[model samples]
Target: MTAWQSIPLIQAEFLAGRAEPRVVTPRGDLAADEQATIALFEQARGSVVFIATTERLFNPWTRNALQVPRGTGSGFVWDNLGHVVTNDHVIAGASGATVRLADGRAFNAVLVGTSPAHDLAVLRIGVGAGRPEPLPIGTSHDLRVGQKVFAIGNPFGLDWTLTTGIVSALNRELPTDTGAVIERLIQTDAAINPGNSGGPLLDSAGRLIGVNTAIYSPSGASAGIGFAVPVDTVNRVVPRLIAQGRYIRPSLGIRTEEQLNAALSARLGIQGVFVLEVEPGSAAERAGIRPARLGREAGFQTGDVIVSLGGRPVRRVADLLAALDRHAPGDAVSVTVLRDGATVDLNVTLDAGR
Candidate 1:
């Protein structure tokens, strides 16, 4: 009997999370039939999958038939209560979704809520008799470029499939099915496939730092450039989805334009968002974020040009939007800006922008 811990990469990848199937007894000698049988057993024993099963339709003869719902893909049990978190796209059209856990257990999962903007979803698994291990949450805020990362999910009905790679990039942005931009994303080299969506992306320490959400291959497989929703965004968005069915976004109320042309640039004498107007009684107004200088020199200006939020420098409207996206309604932030050739700081209370 050999303890599996003796193998470094395979053992850690196995215990911490599923990394990949190890070809065991590579150097050992066994009869052909015996070796083939053992390899098959180990291969099947190594992975976990998350799936969304469709609501079964009843036929006259087999109304009582217990039809097994289809497995979605690689998903981990997020908690003992049987709530599972996965990518929203995985279960998008499924009327019935179920989670397939290790030990060959399948449970009916009700869709709790989802954030299409973030591509994250939550589902409740246990109702009759099942509780699963929930992975510990970790942060993506401080994740470095070379940090090892692991992904656990079912790829193409395969259960508990694990793939390993490193944090390939950070602060990635890509458009969803809709044209809306998904911001502050984590780019990794981890192998994510058709069945890998909604699986947890874990660090070497075995803590979840992101969720496998998208891949770059046109062929719909891992192209060595996969993206995950940073666990930090998940922490902010998921709890709200669990408590309430939606998320609240914070904003600094002002109409802005990106600086582009030399004419507008020279006219304003500054390069930044051209503030058109600030909503009266909004966060910006309260902070006395000065409306654009109107009169003869400035043309039809009424809004304040916001240059920064919470000390993060903002040179464009997207920058301002990104900073506000990180905070929720009622969070107060200090805004810095350029006004009349002077850098001024203002405190503003974010509004729950509908």
Candidate 2:
């Protein structure tokens, strides 16, 4: 009967019933790098925060104003004084914002200051004795392209998530929605998404190096490319924002519109910022920098076209601003301009801008 059905029925049943759970294997200690990363997260998680924004809307039916959920992002405790730092775009149009700490404490945040051009903002809360410690700041100017970096934020509403990557690039320039360009940005592939904006980008030592700002993705998600505002800029801007309620940019006291500069550059086949009007008694005027004026014979005549500032080329309005940003007010700089097809050099001391 075909070898008696291979075996006895009782034996087959016993074999099937003998099956049991497998033994669990013990996992060894984590690697040195793994342990360090885990330790870093545990130590720094308290400094990171989740930010929820709301906008006020008036309902026609109820004839009442309502606070609707606007958006959510991430932020970090800036200091023990309850100053929370985040991206300016995170709270651009929101009527109010709430900051939630890692300890599950939520506090209503007040807008302290904002620098839209730098994409940074500061908020204040009354956390009192329960304030989380601020992150340890690190210099971004010394960061190498291949060094490991960590990002902690609430990505896609996922709270307290961590991502890690190497510094893919540095000194990158990015344009903001406010039509201003932010220079010296740090680029990484750290899985930074929408909610990651305003969160801290830390180094291996758990020191803050940058603020995760934007992602270069077409799908509205992380596509292996992300940008952060370098901590050097943050350090220079945030304290000023906290104290002054605004970041004052250094100005040359010369007015130049972007559209007009572009048109004039095209017409003249030149690549520089055309000084539209030099403010009277201003730095430009003091430096003998001329401005475009109405000409009787030529209809409209272009004056001095700024070619360079402090040895840095100024081709667009953004370039000029960025060049000026490198120096503080009262600092003297060499300005080069093209006047009547001849290059001229002038000295100008910057002034504080509004």
Candidate 3:
């Protein structure tokens, strides 16, 4: 018999002899760093929240209404006044939502404002004495690659989940729902999944550094790559959202293609934003800016191509918008365009964008 075959007999003999039990209590202490991390998680957990949206679906056969789940995502407390910030896409097409706090309290949320260009939205909830404190805002401009970061969010319906990673990169660009590009995004290796959108990306001190926004994955799950809108941008945009009910971007009052890539530019023998159309009675039209026109002989004659705006080179639509956003409405700027193979400079005043 193998040694294993004798175990039952030995156990029975020991049990009959009443052998002493050798049970031992286990005890261990977490390291100081781990303890600190735990403390930070505990501190920041109160601010993160789970958001659920519901939509009314009308059933024609039943002639009734069905309230169904629209979507779910995460958000964090923006201030003491009950303003919660989240991803715009999270609430996109959602008529109404509910916010659930960590302490098991749920509140009906009203959409205060949204900047679809930045993928950010602010919602307001009626406050009581139990309102959670907002997360401390931190600076993302000084962040370095490999710096430790933490993400607190509700990933895949899991509420108040914390995931840790380091800054994988910085100054990344992300396209938003409005076709505008959000620049200077924080890229991290945090495991941000679908439901994590609009949650807080915190630092070691539990300060909000970025807003968890997107994850790069082919499987619709985390692949060790995640992106966040830097807190600096949030700080600048959130206030306007709360006050104005919309974020007004500076505009040059012209229309261009959604994307003017290098290949298309090369094919058209143009090196800048092709002006497809200019708004009538706007700055571009007032400044004598020409729009592309159909030609009888040349087939399609490109209008004045915007090569630069406010002395900044413009190669695409996003670049032009970015350049324009640097200025304010009513600010006069020098717009340089390529007209008939010649560089022409026009002075135009920036306008308030929708």
Candidate 4:
């Protein structure tokens, strides 16, 4: 045979001997737990939203003001009434915000209310008939450590990302930029990052249990320790925000300054909030809670030092506020104070804040 004829014969033999594509093994059904997780994500993803905020910057040279992108975060459909919930910090300085739903529909969001103390904000959008169903609410008080949790958010601007973890701890305390401490926060081991703020943290049943707010990482990224504003707080605050355009925290009708309290507490060698003054005709005045007054000796005659409220120790102003947050305006609570070197327990009915 000639060289060309030999080459064809060799090529034919090689082609005939070559291996065929292996048959794809059937993957059968996914594991039951995996299927459940997938179902949870699919169902919950629609409720989550992407929030982009903008700030208006004034150009001195051109004498013009223009809105520019400020930041991006996450949020969730709160109700059929066009309410959306997110972190206060997410839209703190933004002049405007746009919320994008999972189905690629976008709407301009209007600020309804915000509670900086709770780190929660409510935004309203008119989504019409295509509004997503609100996430089913869950209680955080009964949540136990080690329970499964799934977080859905636009982390790093990557939309609709799902991260799974377990409730590493509960009742965690996180301080906010408003100089107040947010108590009863849920801590999880989920991979929460910068853009994860205002996202939903769901339980195994896909119920909204928390709102991812912050992470405890030195490098400003996920380090397995993420904190969420507990749903219990959210449920209490969001509705009021929607109704009143602000969260009116239950107040004791007593004035207390954080800085003054700290200075007085240290000077007196006592650890409690110092009562500055009681509002006239208020709950504190009605309960006979005394206020500090200037003594003839050029010193303060401390009238009442709040040591406890509702059985929670009040070492600082934040503690008093946190305790009051657990109750309503009309609820009765026990206020323990230091008066004339005696411990006095008084029953006081909370009043609506101004």
Candidate 5:
């Protein structure tokens, strides 16, 4: 059993009904943290959203009424614009859906867009009548493994369920049901069960930083391991969904060897990604992107070894790409090359990789 001693502010749902646990308080009374955590949860769960949907089932019963099925999930108010973000899986195949705010007023919802790769989606609700407090946004990039976080959602049809825990990991590229890798995810020990999908995983300040998306459990319940789509990814994708109804990312147009082996560290002489190829007419190739044609390859196709970019050391192809993310297309940058035991510097202009 993995001990959750590191995250004291929150407890897993599986552990929620268990024995009393000790916690530290400002007064040092040696009391259990459970009660105090519950109180904090109420305060942090700024707003709640109820998503109700109905589906048609294969039941040989009466007319349309018996053929209809229903389901519900949780969501939080995202902004004053009346946008709500949630897990795509939650609203998947919904014939009818609506958002019920904390104030008890309900509004119709329409799918803005969804990224199945990240298991996230944004929806637009008119809120034509009700007043809902939009959840605040926070930077997941600044979250630490042991920092406190709170999750507000409806789990297993339970409305407004709140769970707390500290971040268990960072930059976790966990795969979803479709096996698309979700990049830069925030892993937490917070108890996230069914219906919690798409709910807000907030900081102590009630700022939204992550969207509760998945849990690691063989028993279909909270397994103390949960994954959230980082808010940074949300901020980037949501606007595209709202504006153009699609997401577009210009690629760096380069390919390099993936660093699969940590032990190969000694043989590479340097710690970085190996440049393998620069696609023709790509931003990389046009900007003088070098490819690895030899060294590790066979015959006349020996490639150039790229050791650095813009004066920053690049150990792997991802490193170079990581450095490029800080820049946009048409930007000029300096690249350093390590060839035949000598270093060469070159300036190249980047092209849009769209």
Candidate 6:
């Protein structure tokens, strides 16, 4: 047979002898709840941004200046005038920072204000164009445990990552680098990490409920336990930061232990804060609040025990702090203290904290 005639037969024989491999592709529709979650993410993702900070390093040996990356974190748009909010530790030592939106746009950000006590900070970028939408603010007061929550941020340098979990707890407290305690924190299991700090923690309705601040991970990664500063604290602190560059929490001018314990109160025969030392010229001092004293007769006599303030029971130091925070400086509050088996009432004008 001719070569051309044999070619077709050879090709047909090879094709008929070969086995075909099956290829399968799987595609399924998303569930309704998943669709809603996707929609929520879409609605709020634009408000989130990645923050990169820079610090100037002085090289004494080279006699030259160099700018190096300080760190990276996440932040969200706060207002139309270009206010961005993030964790204070995000920009802790950064000389400057840049805010980058999801659309690949970046801007130089200047520090507006910072409150290390709450682990919150505000940054400002000039308004000209391409400003991300501000998040819809929500009140954390109404949030219940086990309610669905979402967190969007850069985790391990991965930007725009989303994690979903329910509110594990409320009214939690976390310590800040400044030795101040952040109160009324929202605890969640929504996979937060180092880069997730300062991002928004939203409810299922896409409203901002808290600011992701810390994680309870021993390995420096998300261990399914995280905490955020509740919006109630955020609302109170942010405005003050924007206006005054710092948050001034109300104070009674008395210093106590890191926390008040029931044993301490019981030993003192009082169910209130046992005054350790009242400031020399503080409102507490003016109100005749006394410090715990050492007595020869009683061995160790409790000077004064504050039982209540402004009609609110002060069972612990936190209660006293929360009560004081409700009023501003110069506001007169009625303080009741147990003094020598008798209850005494004193009016004290609140003073600014030192």
Structural similarity to truth (TM-score) of each candidate:
0.62, 0.73, 0.72, 0.73, 0.65, 0.73
Per-candidate Cα RMSD to the true structure, in Å, reads: 13.9, 8.9, 8.3, 9.1, 12.3, 7.5
What C-alpha lDDT does candidate 2 achieve relative to the native structure? Answer: 0.91
Stretches > 4 Å off in candidate 5: 1-46, 56-67, 253-287, 290-354
lDDT of 1 by residue, 176-284 (tens): 8866677778899988888888887888767788888889998887789999988878877787788777666686777654323224556766655556677888887
Q: Tell me how far the alpha carbon of residue 17 in candidate 2 is from the true structure, in angstroms, after superposition.
A: 4.4
Model 3 TM-score?
A: 0.72
> Roughly what TM-score does model 5 have, to 2 decimal places?
0.65
Better of 3 and 4 by lDDT: 4
lDDT of 3 by residue, 161-262 (tens): 889999999878887767888777899998999999999999998999999999989999999999999887788779888988888877767766433444
What's the lDDT for all of these models? Answer: 0.72, 0.91, 0.88, 0.91, 0.73, 0.87
Ranking by lDDT: 2, 4, 3, 6, 5, 1
Q: Rank the candidate models, highest TM-score first.
A: 2, 4, 6, 3, 5, 1
Whole-model lDDT for model 6 versus the true structure? 0.87
- How good is model 2 by TM-score? 0.73
TM-score, predicted candidate 4 vs. hidden true structure:
0.73
lDDT of 5: 0.73
With candidate 4 superimposed using the best TM-score fit, by how many Å does residue 313's alpha carbon deviate from the native?
Answer: 21
- What tens digits encode model 2's per-residue C-alpha lDDT throughout 170-260? 7788988767888778999889998999999999999999999999999999999999998877887898898889887888889876556
Flag clash pairs in model 6.
Answer: none
**Deviation in Å, model 6, residue 54 alpha carbon:** 0.9
Model 1 TM-score is: 0.62
lDDT of model 4, residue 140: 77
Off by over 4 Å in 1: 1-49, 55-71, 127-130, 253-354
